[model samples]
Target: MKVLVFLLLIITTITSKGWAQDCLGMTLKAGTSYEMSTFNAKDKPTGKISYQVKDVHKEGSSTVMDITAQFEDEKGKQRTPYVIHYTCTGNELIADLSGMMQSMQATAMKDAEMKLKSNKLVYPGKLSVGQKLSDGQMEAEMVSNGNTMMNMNMVMSNRQVESKAPITTPAGTFDTYKIKSDMSFESRVMGIPIRNSMQVVSYRVDSQIFDIKSETYNKNGKLMGYTLLTKAN
Candidate 1:
């Protein structure tokens, strides 16, 4: 039973299906663009991030995603990355944020990978309106080389992520579901070997159109950070 549950979570996280009409088969619409207007913890509307995506090419069963974005950092400086590469196999998705990280000192990429693995949250089969996917129940530990990281148990769910980032203008809003999950991982930063339980809440949104919104929150149930789909080709 435990193995079955874990396998399901892995599949859901890896596949992350949806966007059949907009993304699959057809190439990304040329000149596609969008923007993310971020908000601080106070929810005070802050700066903005803009992206332009182009479909470089398609190979076999994968669609190549080329993305670039411009945003202001905490120090109020405007910066943009060259481009981030991502690919989608059917409904599964993968992104490379290392390029973006070069300009900004954010831990977003690392956090994203961890969140992807930990949350294991995605739509069950296809992407559509009013569809929901529950990972049922999962319990595991962060292990490395047969060493214990942390023991955790959680129920992860995923719905359609809506994108509200604007295209014509360089600003917009994104809204998504509040994911209520629980998990534990080895505390590498904390330098602790003890197990700790965390009640995880990941914020996300789906737009009226086809863009997706995804964000991460701390245990306080506040928006610690987020990921936005600013553009698609």
Candidate 2:
């Protein structure tokens, strides 16, 4: 269950800075689909997730896309469904933070109203060696069924572009920027403090606003799991 929480914290929709139109360059071709898989530290398959482009609308220089994400359980039954919007205008790509966290809050607390105080970074306009960008902060409070449940705050202080490389996977080869970030999370429940942090290495490609691959680690610096792009168009 803890693993699940760690994974959901980074369940990002897209990338960018300052409400800029930053995107993963993910093919906005309508009707195209991509499947990504999760693997444990040993490379054992654990779960599957998919994203599909539902619609695309061109509004002058910016393009708006409707995307649906589906998560399946071990038995292949869809357990989670979410929808988000992305705008590709300017030189960057941006995602609706409220929209991106809707599903996450729903999963975290049933029938709770959520307000996201932190913004998410999906992509930036540029990347270079040793360049670091602030990914921003996310804070939310959840009250479920009239009971005050919990509050969460996570901050991504900086993202450093480590290098550019060609990553080959089942989906194909993609030119990617390897970006690293340190994220800290804190929560309070019944006056008990829960704190943790993790290291993330995300492979972002010019072809998509979504990460081509993502790796996660625990605060102890142990590699816990990773995600791989299996199919994308």
- Top candidate on TM-score is 2
Error of 1 at 90 (Å): 2.2
Where in model 2 is the C-alpha error above 4 Å? 1-27, 58-61, 97-100, 145-147
Candidate 2 — worst ten consecutive residues by lDDT sum?
Answer: 12-21
What is the total number of backbone clashes in candidate 2?
20
What would you estimate as the lDDT of candidate 1? 0.40
Predicted candidate 1: what Cα RMSD to the true structure? 10.2
Poorly placed runs, candidate 1 (over 4 Å): 1-22, 25-27, 73-76, 104-215, 225-233
Error of 1 at 161 (Å): 9.6
Q: What lDDT, from 0 to 1, does candidate 2 have?
A: 0.69
RMSD of each candidate?
10.2, 5.0
Q: What lDDT score belongs to each candidate, Candidate 1 first?
A: 0.40, 0.69
